[model samples]
Target: MMTNPTKMERRRALQDSLNDRINFIKSVEEIFNCHMVNFITGNLWDKHIPEPIKEEVAQLGEEKVLELIYHFGSCNSKLEVKMELTAPCPTLSKYLIACRQYYYDMTDPSINDEESIRSEILNDSSTSVSDADDNIKKRNLSSQYLTPAKKRHEVDVMSSFIAKMYEKKLANQGIIGAIVDIGGGKGYLGSALALRYGLRVLGIDVASDVTDAAKSRNDKICRKLSEKCSFYQQKTVFVTPNTDLGNLVKEFQFLWGSVTRVALVGLHTCGNLGASNIELFAATKTTDVPVTILCNVGCCYNLLDEKYLPEGVIDKAHYCLPPLLHGHSVDLPLDETSGFPMSDFLCQRQFWLGRNARNLASQSVERVMSQKKVAVDALFHRAVLQTVLLDYAENCSDTVQKKLLSKLDEMMVVGKGVGRVYKRNASLNLHEYLKTAFEKLDLDIQLPVEEVDKLSERYDCFKSKIKIFYLIRIFLAPVIESIILLDRLLYLLEKGINEAYLVRLFDPLISPRCFALVALK
Candidate 1:
């Protein structure tokens, strides 16, 4: 009555199944649009992507572009909402759906009758078993992801999927002895993995407040998730007060000298701190003990090496902009800690507009008194001074003081691109204004204006180089992933590990936000 499928026929059927899966993914992506598509596709990563990774990478990049757009691409601050992968691969999707179904089945009250229960179990259990059987069949059909390959192929793919891509990346083979998280605020990322994956985690931060907060959070999480992270409270240590990064590394090594497999994971490590971790890994090398992995999610690249060059950090006195901005080495007499506050930077450019308005108004008597270092309650009189600067002749009680501030404000330039910002009808060419300012400043100096211009040009050129460095750090994650693959190959050649595999499993919901680093030996 029925004919069995031939080998060739079976192969064709499998190919058709794969086509269906691919089409399903593509259709979902299209439906979700770019941003949502990126979030969802991240769960479908493979080590050797038969298809290009560029499409997903570009989609993920849109998340950053969205942030740039929200603040009108302001020089300071970024959009705060985090992008997450909501849908992963079909397997994960099914798992999630099944879990939800199970939860609902347990909690939801359904019409219960003896006959209905018996019928449902008899029919539904068989259907579920058939569905499970179909899932096993589909696994083979999805050859691109589940194709029979060497163990190494699977591991490489899995590793690429689970781990966040980073630069100067580290690969771990055997047991991870200790994980030191640098600038690991709250140790959320590191602690999570340590608890889940079973490792000792040390959270290193300069701020005692941050470390203490992380400890509290860790304790709270441990209390709630005692079953899952029972060892987390015991294994995790918070280290602070010693912000000196180099000294911290030395101390860490001294404490755990016997640890062979060490990993350093940092989420949003700021400024030059991220780069310092790389240097520590490269500089501190041993034949017996090796730093296995260094994972960093770096933010605020503008705060990197103060000098305009790669070698800037070596010289203590040389002050440069954080990796992201103009690096000027003619020290501003400000220490490493002195710079624009994150609060100020993260505020919208509108805050600068308020400052500009204040600058444009004429200075008040109170302002003059404050400038002369007189003890005036400048805050209380600021409102009165504002009205006087606008030339509103309101005979307020503080008219005399307001008049003085208005005059002073008239002398001061607004929108000079320094302290406060003012919006111009048309975009102001800040570079041109800077050139003019430089020329004017040279008028009083013995140095010729032409010489000053030459110096400015040199500084600009150096700043460009610094920008390149920042860009590299900004995109370090992907670059690191690539490097770690090469490291794995090298490790294979050296016989440090054997019969191992790696793979990158991407989530489909959050634009493949993370990879599942599968290690199978």
Candidate 2:
């Protein structure tokens, strides 16, 4: 039987394959820009959609598109949805099927299944000499621990995987060490590692309140372990790539005695922090100790710094990388310190996905399909509210228009709250609800009850167009998300870090931003 490739080998393979297809990335960006640019700009209301795409969608027939959406959207199961994408459409059938398949290909079942979890965890990295013994130990320990309250099953699995990886690193590298949890909110994963694996942990966060909470939580966990396990908290910014992590540890005097290696781990580190951790681990080189392992799961792509992109690509208008990278040459020099494609190569050819597109990328198709009606209703209501705001603005003076539109921005929040309440109580009167919500907003310009009723009545006419637009946006979500994830993966590979691996580490249905970027030296 052919054995699976090691993590480094896999990273190199992915990098080489993707890098060779620089033109393919450009083509993907063009397709998204052509089909999804308008959808990315704002809500799926009538005016937000581009005229050409709107005409094409209209020609495909709204009834057919709506039919296809409801047929695929109301699927009893994910498998059924994948199988049922056979409905014919003039333009959208191919795109709809592609979206469904993308979701299937990305879903990682082993993260949630108990029987396969251990093998999955062990397979994530290159096999060490003590693999068999480590697997057996992890299997025994998996049953002994209780998953913390309100924590997803995927997180439990991730903590166990990271803990096991830490052990493997310790044994293989022969370094007595401590685990540093960057952005360790509430110290849930850190405490678990300390209690279950008996590894000393230093949970770091920017918020003093969160650090204090993590300390209190760790105290309880240490008590339960019946052994004095050190779980320290430091409130400071630690994600900067140039920050001297070795000196920071020295200042805190954490795990000062006989500590020669550190395992840097972050469970769903937000925004640029994940990328920064990767850079920090690669750049930090101390004579006495070193960061041997780095594991990070990142979310919120919209928050990433545009400065991290190749030079001369940082457009002040947009805060996203793709917009800056689009239509540019892919050949740029790599950063010496981090190996990131600073300017040259495929990094120059990077595609632009707007903030809304990035946000949409994190949504789960399975969850959306399961809650199809609710999702549809929510979109329908949002579109209607947008229409109401537009109408209200059209009727008002310049000053009133500005004031009313500012307050109408709150309509999204109100709509979301109302949608949730409406789902539980189907008999809930929406018109009355809207009136109450709008009244509470206390806009200087009066939107009388009758005017609100008129807007609510227009929902029936707008529902079909809104539903079709929503479905199109949903169909393009995965494609846009794939580019964002690949960029990060490529950034690591460009940095010459061969051990970096991008693994689907959570169930997207429960946690949409579930991919973990792991590296070890």
Candidate 3:
């Protein structure tokens, strides 16, 4: 990963980086393009995986496959990656190595090397006494502000990276005095920047309630560190393509603030927020507070819009969502187009990764091993539940029937929504999963033992097979993520932002969405 985005010919860099990845993606395109819920929930004993990879998994069995998974864990202290496991399952093993090797130049956390997540310059000796003081003070933030230890690790990295850039921005242009923190939550990033770097910050959140909460939190923090903390403010606005950020904050007050120059930044921005920030950065030609730079870290690949999955495509994901969220994915607006394929290169290639694939891309083999649980059960539940949903559709009214699959016709129907019935991180017992899910779907309380048994039989002999099937999908996670992130970098490059760059900004185990996209004008 290029930590110092100071010097580089970005155009050639992006082109060179993109070429092989394009080839890699083309070769493995079918793996990610399939509807995974449909595929994984199918007969893993027979289909749902490539024959070569399937044979490889069958030969290696479950324990070896799991050991290989443990080799990828990083960023979490509790999880130690087993160094250099033998390549027993050649097909999947090679895929894992290739994925990690591909990551080497980006984040440097390959399976052969376990300590790559430790930053080279993280504890760099600073001549600035204030910098040293601030670093020491930051250690107390987790205890003081109720931030998680893992979260503090993320904040430290981002703070260091952004502060270095901000200093250069100040020394050269001397214009940017504040950052526009997009998708900021309760001004955490703002607090860090202001506390350590003496930078002014304006935290903008899409949620009004959060913005209000931020004000209260900021007031408390400000009073505690009144002398050191100069300025941090919060605002609530749904920043859109048409949003004029300069004008939005023009009337806003700042104690130690200037609108002459500003940077648009977001840390682990969920879904479209990251995309929207980048778009805002590009679109803004503001006279009020000129956004001279941008830095964004995006998560939730599944939350991203699918370019081809039309706006009206039934959001079969959220069954119990309120009426306000009925027509959309969540609180955010859905566009017919997506934030993906941002570069002309990818757009021209007609590249597409469906919802299941995107969700799969969000999976971390590292986290999977660290936690020691494959979402095999959750996925199993969802898949078997898909059949129930299909069966239930037969009883619904004509209007309701039109929205779902009429039969178990596996032509193109997506398995959606039943996962919504269960808690995201809950380890579900099969009985509980059935009871709760059945009740949620308005099915009979009496357990459908026979139907469930028939479905269970499809996967009973293939638990190892199912785990291995998931391993490969999880292995492909970072590769596809790298492609998506690189696409964003390429997008900036195509836009002629020569200073545009990507960095491995967070520890992958602590925070899976570690790559950040940055640019300066």
Could you tally the backbone clashes for each prediction? 76, 10, 0
**In model 1, which runs have C-alpha deviations exceeding 4 angstroms?**
1-173, 228-258, 286-288, 309-331, 334-521
Model 3 local distance difference test score: 0.63
lDDT digits (tens) for residues 1-521 of candidate 2: 54555555555555554443334334333333322212222333454455555665666677655667666555422635433434345335554555555444432221112223234447633442123234424311232334443254554667667777766668555767777888988877776666555666677888888888887766665566565645454555645777655555555453445666777888877766776777777774554667877778777664554334435432122211133223322223323333222222345655344334445665555566666543455555544544554556667687876665444433321211222334454543445445544555554435576776776685566656655665666655655555555556556555666555566666666666766767767
* RMSD (Å) per prediction: 23.6, 8.0, 6.9
Model 2 quality (TM-score) = 0.72
Off by over 4 Å in 3: 1-13, 34-41, 72-88, 107-143, 171-176, 224-230, 241-254, 257-259, 284-289, 306-337, 387-416, 420-429, 448-458
Q: Write candidate 1's Cα lDDT for 179-285 as tens digits.
A: 66667666555455444344445676767788787777767665665534432322223333223333333445544444445555554455445445544443333
lDDT of 3 by residue, 169-266 (tens): 65346564577898888777877777666667789987999998877886787677554444677788778867877775565544553467677889
Stretches of candidate 2 exceeding 4 Å from the true structure:
1-87, 100-152, 231-235, 250-256, 284-287, 307-347, 405-430, 444-450
With a 3 Å backbone cut-off (N, CA, C), the pairs that clash in candidate 2 are: 322-352, 323-352, 330-345, 331-344, 331-345, 332-343, 332-344, 332-345, 333-344, 339-495
Between candidates 1 and 2, which one is better according to TM-score? Answer: 2
Ranking by lDDT: 3, 2, 1
Q: What are the Cα lDDT values of the candidates?
A: 0.31, 0.54, 0.63
State the weakest 10-residue window (summed lDDT) of model 3: 109-118
The best candidate by TM-score is: 3
